[model samples]
Target chain A: MGKQGNYSFTGHIRPRQIRAGALRLRATFCLGGFSFLAFIVLTITGVLLLFYYQPGDRAFASLSEINSVLPYGGFLRSLHFWAGQLMVISVFLHMVRVVWSRAYRPLRELNWITGVVLFGLTVILDYSGYLLRGGQESGAAATVGQALFTSLPGGKALATVFFGQPSPLNGSTLNMFVWHVFILAGAVGFLQMFHFWRIRRGGGVRPL
Target chain B: MDLIESERPQVPVEVEQSGSQEKLPLIELQVREYIGTFLWLGLLFALTAGLKVPLDSSPKAAAISISKAPWVFGAIQWLLQRWPAWLSGWVLPLLSMSVLLTLPWWGRKVGKTWAWIIFLILSLVWVGLTFVYWSESIN
Candidate 1:
């Protein structure tokens, strides 16, 4: 198991060597890497938040306490918020970079599709995170989202599953809490791993 | 057979390289990543420390005159106010997403420049709408 053990999951994700051209700032602009970095920041802050955050009716109150009472709680929450916003912007920019470089063509097409899906999920995750704030604004946003979901054929059940009976005054719900923290976040994490692996398997970033 | 063919990774074209084409150890890239990570984190911390994220009015507060969507959904909310829910909320977004999802195929069919133009137009429209919504909110 000497050298063979080196061929593990981490090894596959980060190969021993890369094309030197990929190191140039102009080649990829590191937008994808930036986006992933934001994700890592968000995951750390979010888990910390989960320690004090309460879902449903206690949502807003819990957050207020975290903001005012807990040590560095507000800072952590602010970090999570900024990181979330940055991730959305960076992911969109990364997509633009991919299209600009024509990296989505041919062998990398699946990665592009995965990226698009990830983009959609990122936006939805942002929206869901907003709802978790349990403010009047969140309630309004939830209303709009629910309306969009219900407009589809057989979408009433779908809306219920996703929005989970949010009140007009407060959007936080156990249902949305699970989706935001566990389901959507988990899927993004998994897809990102697949995305990075695909890039490596495709012989690293294509040079301009 | 067709599926396998479609999934096949593209073969890299061999080109005569100058002295600069040397491959480097992954640690070099990792070092760059670490630097980038620190820089990015610095910007995030600066933003967090300088600007406070305001909490929305409490749920129990009297009904506010205006309720805004999160900035990310500002574009959709802007449209929803003017257009039918079906159009603004559902069709337009789904249509835009469909266009984005098919961009690689667009590149193949109409050429890369056209595909890039199509993507740019789509991105600008949504981003423009978001800005418009934000400006209106501020005013």
Candidate 2:
């Protein structure tokens, strides 16, 4: 017996005890692990980006300087961008894998639901990041986003709550910066921990 | 496989003992996670090192007429081009999410079918929109 002999950890099992097809890479694609990795990468790169980023009208200019002037700043920005995109892709794939494997049955449903919410957060995180860039693309996205928000039921109030007033010199970009840097990211992290806890309670990965 | 039987997890020891069942410490999983993450980071750096982070001029003076949303929002952007903003922007995404949230309660076949159908439709729309945007740019 190894030192880990029946250690009774919450979310693990002996590697040998997996089902016939369970050990195959296709079963899960290790997406959950990859998504977590992407999040961590994003966090580190995002923090690095903060030093160079100035929200609002100067946001675009700040990004330009970061890409052109700062040491390895472009690299950090690129890493953050790629990590966010990777997180979105992996999280979506993770959900698909879960559904495909029928892993949402019975006691596992809560985790599935949490996963869905996480997907939404991940998208928003990506969107907010783009908006922080304050490029033409981001400006258009913000306009559309505001339109979408206002078009929904109670959307006017919801938009106000989320986006604040859209003044020419308004703090919307700064608001988005806060969300991208802290609130949304923190929420996703918290939800992810809860998600993992739920999975643990439901018993690790479901056998394929 | 019976739903009831499938719901009960198959213990590894009872299932297959092809000498694959090396019960290592949970730390092994953590180690694997770190290695996988590092490799992914290395690949990401290698791939993106030469590629610049795109910042198109600036929004300080650009006209919104030719502006576009990120690729992920391409589907909604297309729908916005074709349909009412509220419908495409608010209703479509919300409806899809609603369906997704409630999917687990549906019967297995029905749930899976709906999921696949929704995923396929949305993905096709997104891809099609990307093509449309690209073609428009080229022209």
Candidate 3:
């Protein structure tokens, strides 16, 4: 009682006095943070991939050049491959942690659905990334994975937008690549923004 | 008396803090924590199966092995194999939605553990059906 303590700054004050478990919250947050890190890793490697890698053109030559000649090209490709797989894995683990905690109940349902939407986006993102390359495995993935497209009633028009014009790196494939790399950014942004908004709006899950 | 007393959440903090509360059961631990995790993982795998995400080869190469459907859709895959596509694709989704929607009421009566167990049992059946889908692949 030597000195009366000043009230916490209104700006800095968290409103609720959380005198209980913060570690769980931090752990869940760490899972999400790691997912973001994986995403960043994928993005960096993807961009580096674009430098020596031509999309849809001499698919074999471009890959061969990258593999045989470009500086750290092989490393970049491997990094992209591993990062994509890791991001998918991390996102799955993050969702599991959230659901198991019963954090997705009630007021958080919409956000939970958004989480599902984000999960779909992540799958689509990985799937689309494969298309840009469209090598043998990617080609097999595209064909056998035809179920990736939902209700392709419009078919040709949409396929062009998604797969590009199916030319020698021209038409719909490259355009699709542009959409995948750029427009998909908006969807990912929505995922993070809405996710945090719901948590802030609904407050967090009760500690176990 | 103490066990019955703990039911009232509004009990004075001192009373609620009484050290003699009963611990939850083992299945309670599993149903509550594990079911959701398993269901989601199952769904991820099931979707990969549906898309046939090429485990080994490319379009030029054919899929030589049969793959499982995503775990979430395992139930539907099950019904599709045993029942009909209309039932699996349409009716099954409706039924599952109803289960999830009514979960709170069921949870209230049966408790979360039983509710979780029931849903998990449904999920397990779904996973079983995915194997049937795998058998149909025959390549």
Ranking by lDDT: 1, 2, 3
Badly placed stretches (over 4 Å) of model 1 are A1-8, A205-208, B1-20
Q: Measured by TM-score, how close is model 1 to the native structure?
A: 0.93
- Give TM-scores for every candidate, taking all chains together and pairing residue i with residue i: 0.93, 0.81, 0.57
Per-candidate Cα lDDT values, in order, are 0.87, 0.70, 0.52
DockQ metric for all predictions:
0.49, 0.34, 0.08
- Candidate 2 vs 3: which has more lDDT: 2
**How far does residue B119 in candidate 2 sit from its true spot (Å)?**
4.7
Give interface RMSD, per candidate: 4.5, 6.2, 12.0
lDDT string, candidate 1, B1-139, tens digits: 0124455454445522543356788888888888888888899999999999978778888977556799999999999999999999988999999999999999999999999999999999999999999999999
Tens-digit per-residue lDDT, A90-179, candidate 2? 898887778776677667777888998999899888877877777776766677788888877789887766665543322237678777
Clashes of each: 0, 2, 20
**Candidate 3: stretches off by over 4 Å:** A1-20, A25-29, A145-152, A165-172, A205-208, B1-139
Candidate 3 reaches a DockQ of 0.08
